[model samples]
Target: MRKDRKNTHLKCCIMEISGRITKDAVTAKVSNDREVVNFSIAINDSYRPKGAEELKKIVTYIDCSYWMGSKMAQWLKKGTVVELFGRIGLNVYNNAEGKALGSLTFHTSNIKILVFPKTENSSSLPAVQKKNTDQDTPDDLPF
Candidate 1:
């Protein structure tokens, strides 16, 4: 009884995450012979104005990660503004009191820096390249 052809034929999954970066840390290491960059991105949810009750702005934090690469980890710092496109993965962490803390990981596919972080040791991202070299190499085989 499925009559929706557009929904079945085209598979679309796009998640866009945007917020002020918080608790941003970068650590690159080889764990069990595999290299991975471990980092965290905090997303804050801003509260919308709800009528005339006179409430302050509420903020919520969400922790995310990217396992695809460490380029973002090395280039970001706390309080940096960023927009990201990524997939989601969930993980569980425990504190010293034995309580479980869970987080959703964003495996980054694309990242855009909105603003430089406001810290003394804030990281500097690599500069964007403005060169195109697709026509520099010949496609015809000489052999």
Candidate 2:
């Protein structure tokens, strides 16, 4: 809550959500040659209903857009987990068939990388180092 010049209190809607990236981020030039990073995340949630013996799983996918820069797209790969802080918005529009559709959108202001997906190249580094270390002798050490 914040007070404006009129001495009235105002409410701000800011949300934080953490989820796994659904796909690699894409950069697009929207207007005035400005680039925006676009990505989607899947948030997994589960809940148990009353008198239920099992838990029900739910997944919510939110489309995110970051206007700060496009360089962050390189790290925002599929399966990477990130925490985003921003505002949520709902877009309601009519489809080509005249049916109404709605989707959730997040205007991300800040992003924190939580977990990075392991790539084949990254996963092979340790094995290659281990193989080299196994062949090394104490006499090979210059020190």
Candidate models: Cα lDDT each: 0.61, 0.83
RMSD for all candidates, in order, please. 13.4, 9.7
Error of 1 at 60 (Å): 2.9
Worst 10 residues of 2 by lDDT: 1-10
Per-residue lDDT of 1-143 in model 2, one digit per residue for the tens?
Answer: 22121212223577899999999899999988699999999999999999999999999999999999888888888889999999887666666666667778888999999987888766522232335665566756777
What's the CA error at residue 142 for candidate 1, in Å? 53
User: What TM-score goes with each of the models?
Assistant: 0.56, 0.75
For every model shown, the clashing-pair count is 0, 0
Candidate 2, which segments miss by more than 4 Å at Cα? 1-12, 123-143
Q: Please give the range of 10 consecutive residues that has the lowest summed lDDT in model 1.
A: 1-10
Clashes of 1: 0
TM-score of 2: 0.75
What are the runs in model 1 whose C-alpha is more than 4 Å off? 1-12, 30-33, 48-51, 92-101, 119-143
